[model samples]
Target: DATLLHSNGLTVLPTGTDNDITLFGPINEIAPDAGIFESDIAIRYFDGPASASCPTTTAAATLLRIEGDLIVPLGGPATSCILQGDILTVEYTDPTDASGDPNTVTDSATFDLRNGVLQSDKSVYIIGADMILTVIEPDWDRDNDGAETYDLDAIEWDSDAATVTMGNAGGEGAAFDPEPSSLRETGDSTGIFQVVIEIPNTLAGDKLERGEEVVLEYTDWGPSGADYVGDEDEDINLTIFTSNFGATVELDQKVYSWTDKVYITIVAPDHNFDSNLIDEIGNSAEDPIKVATRGTDIDPYKLVETGTDTGIFTGEVILTGFTAHDADGDGVEGDASGTTAGVGPTDGFLAADDDDGITVSFEFSEDETVVGSALIRWNIGEVQWLEASYPATGTGVVRVVDPDMNLNPEAVDNFDTDVWSDSDAGGIDLTVTETNEATGIFEGTVFFTVTDESSGHRLRVAEGDTVTAEYEDNTLPDPYTTADELDITGTSIIGTIVPPLERAPASGIRVVDAFGNSLGEISVDQQVQITSDLANGQDRAQAFAYLVQVQDDNGVTVSLAWITGSLTAGQSFSPALSWIPDAPGTYTATAFVWESVDNPTALSPPVKTTVNVI
Candidate 1:
């Protein structure tokens, strides 16, 4: 039986050319960090004499990792030694194997060293997107280090070494050859040479399309007049990665007043890898987008790019409401309007009204088009209670939105509204005011009273009564968006229900400060108020006695305090009594509500809680 260790001796990276074969492994892959460095790992020319690229009989590997490809160079533009029989061998020894002696392991794989190799280094080639492919010439490494690196200025190129002839090899392959394109070196004599091939749409003419296939082939068959020795060639079969294009439309706001401007935005894709169509969009031969609302076209209002290269476009128009204010309606879209608004696109104009959707659309490459639409709506308002329930004595908070009144916040308009209650037909007439200028959110706080009618700060309400607040905008039509809605007269209603008499009067004790904030624990001799929420839920007022008692661990009452107060109908009030803990000990504080101190008539349940003094 053979002992197994965690080392993985051989693995090759995928990128290959005639020049190099990269192996990046043989570490203890199962180790904590996939790294167990050992000096035994080595690389060699499988079974050949030591050549210029290899030093000793066995050159073991040192860079052991799955990352950073460790390239092992092979001599060839097409070296005869690079035949199917030629191979690179890697070996490693694991001294820690279960076997008492050092265990040796070996692995090998064959790689290609082509004469003329094509390298794009991209997983995808998007059509209409420009890309560069490189052609590497033969390589020679006299230094016995398996890496294709020449001395400071080892190999250089100054002129055209060979002509590259490109042709299509899709569908039925044929001998249809086009004019030859020259292979340009990136710099002087840097073996890496580049060639530019245009896709069917952009720089490349009518040679490609969405569904069809386009094959690009470049060959250097003969040893030519270049800086290197042998000739190389490559066949690259590419399936055009075509994409269906589309766009989206949005408005600043869905609804608009008769005089409000409509802000429009359009985001369309140009079917390119990166946003390279900035030069063609926004200021294209024709308007990139079209806008229409009331059954007619509106001037495209010189759409502009949203950013340096975002492909998103935006344009704004003053809603001049009419098919055209005069006979100017039937004019053309930006077909006649200049590309800039400063100069004025006087011919084409669009006026929007509360009608069908405002449509903004654009056609992209091919006949594919994208359309975005939104309807112009009536400026109706909305009303909502901050919370649906509140005690009759607590404040009722309502938020109002009246586009007609809130539309202009710089003036900070305050509009009168009504908050009526079920208990009384007549209620408080409240005026709502604005706070945040940008959102124009109007809020009105009304202190609800049981039987008193109050102004801005008061709305008469009762226990279990429904408080209704209706903010009406007379500019909106009752049947909104109708032809009769030329006027805004919509009503927004919010009805809040006061908490009912779910339970009778109750009292509870909490050690609190002067501000009624609970003091979770008290120090010895600390004077704190024991408070209770005393409330009356009757149709008539009631006199109540609130009492608090503290008992020590011995069950003897150490402190007792009481208060008498009158609670109006549906009124919630708090009463407090002072208590001083004389010593550090465990105590329980209990509160009780009764008819009076003399008449011990319990009106509700008494509440008790344990308190710790530290």
Candidate 2:
């Protein structure tokens, strides 16, 4: 259009004829419309010195202006105005990201804002608790100045009760109206108003139920009654919550064997209100959780928080089967049964049998309790002998197969059994354990030990005696016996005296020629026999290792051989290993005997002789 001069004197910095700034005719103009108008403004510089900042250029001088036309429809100024907020964007190069294009960011000082905003401090409010519904009217503070929540003199409520309709979520319950004049200011001149709604907790008279929703609807009214809506309404939806432990317990495995470690996980939503993971419940202290093999005698177990703000807890408990008599029958056992707590690992020692039930419970609060259960089964265990029979001086190997037993490859799962001569009934206690949890096979060594003066677990018996190994399966009930035995007869049926071997070498070794003769002289390309005359000098059969080594004149071994087998009582044998000579030289032959190749213990002094390989 055209430029009309107004008396608001606009001036430049220096007041002079050459420096004074003059108004120019408009290049583009805007007429108030329904939508926002945007454009840029520029200043035309005339007759500027030619320097590095700006080079001399002869361009036509012009001016331009950019603006967003504002329009208020509710009323005129003083009564209502548009709450406008804008963002000035900029793009610049960042040294840290040189290879990428220029980075763009929003101006932090400014953000988007609007009117008729409604919100609450919390998402869900517990039933029977106090709730505050906040309302923000940007038009009330359009000038950015503060306004009170309740203005008695203003025609805001029309001198009548403000009807803010409160209803259940999804229209589940009947609409309930809050108290009259419930509107109040949240802060001084904050322009934020809130209506405090008191929720009833009494189940008998309470109109709201757990899992229900709460909706707040508020409409502004001028001189009209609160029932009249001046414009669109502002509303918010929230949830009605209930307080309790509400935790779920899960066992890592559905089935477990005796003496196995039970892993437990408990997930309780909203349990930890704080952001930190330090919060705890049903812990070792306060109200300690218990996982008992029986119903009455609950044992204290340890549980800890899994992570920050997770509301999840994890723990591990060891099951003591019937052998340990760790159970809490049908009665109350640990502090889990009480309203308070107790210092404990487990108070009740009630024995648990196979197919017994395990009780896990905790006291979340004095009024609330959480309980869970699992199954404990211990099958009838069976034992197997590594051999059919054993000599009086031989060791016995007992392998127990019990799926009800927790097997650990690391050899931690261990249990005790007994073996004795059935004739004398003098039993010796032995420890058997599982290796390789996948296969529930346990093995232990039963040595034929000597009769020491003081005896605790000593089984001294001669040949022909029947050794009975009894596996006490505690899983069996009282009416049924728990003893399962395996009777193994001694190697000899006549009670004879067999030979016994030492832990190390008991005889000497020697080397012989290929024809089984003493080493003397051997021709090139001829092989010589190296042998050791070993005998079972004791009562029992013993394992033996015989070795023969042939070396050159410089003491470097050129040939080596060995023979391994068992030597029975009073048995004599000669083991020979051969060595061939390739070159004509003075070769030395040496033979040695040991307990076994695995153990290089010299059973006898090594003997050597020289051979002429020519």
Which candidate has the highest lDDT of all? 1
Residue 199 lDDT (model 2): 46
Kindly give the stretch of ten consecutive residues in candidate 1 with the minimal lDDT sum: 152-161
lDDT of candidate 1 over 1-614, digit per residue (tens): 22322223343333332223433345444556756554323332332333444333222223222324443433322222222234657677888788678898998875434355556544344455544655665432222323232221111111121112332323111121111244454554455566544433422223233433333344443223321222243333322343344556677876654334456666654433354444234334333456666655653445656664576766665433432211111232221111112211222345544444566666544555567666654456677777767777788677876544433323454666667777655776677787655244678887877767665567666665777776654445336533222221222222333233222366555779777788888898788888777677665567888888899888999988898888877789888889888888789888888778998778777888777887
lDDT tens digits, residue span 404-458, model 2: 5453322345666767774456566677777665356778776664443213444
| Per-model TM against the reference | 0.41, 0.37
Model 1 / residue 471 / CA error / Å: 3.2
Candidate 1 is scored at a TM of: 0.41
In angstroms, the error of model 1 at 319 is 6.3
Give candidate 1 regions above 4 Å deviation: 1-115, 118-128, 137-182, 186-191, 195-214, 223-282, 295-297, 301-351, 383-398, 402-440, 444-470, 475-498, 502-536, 539-614
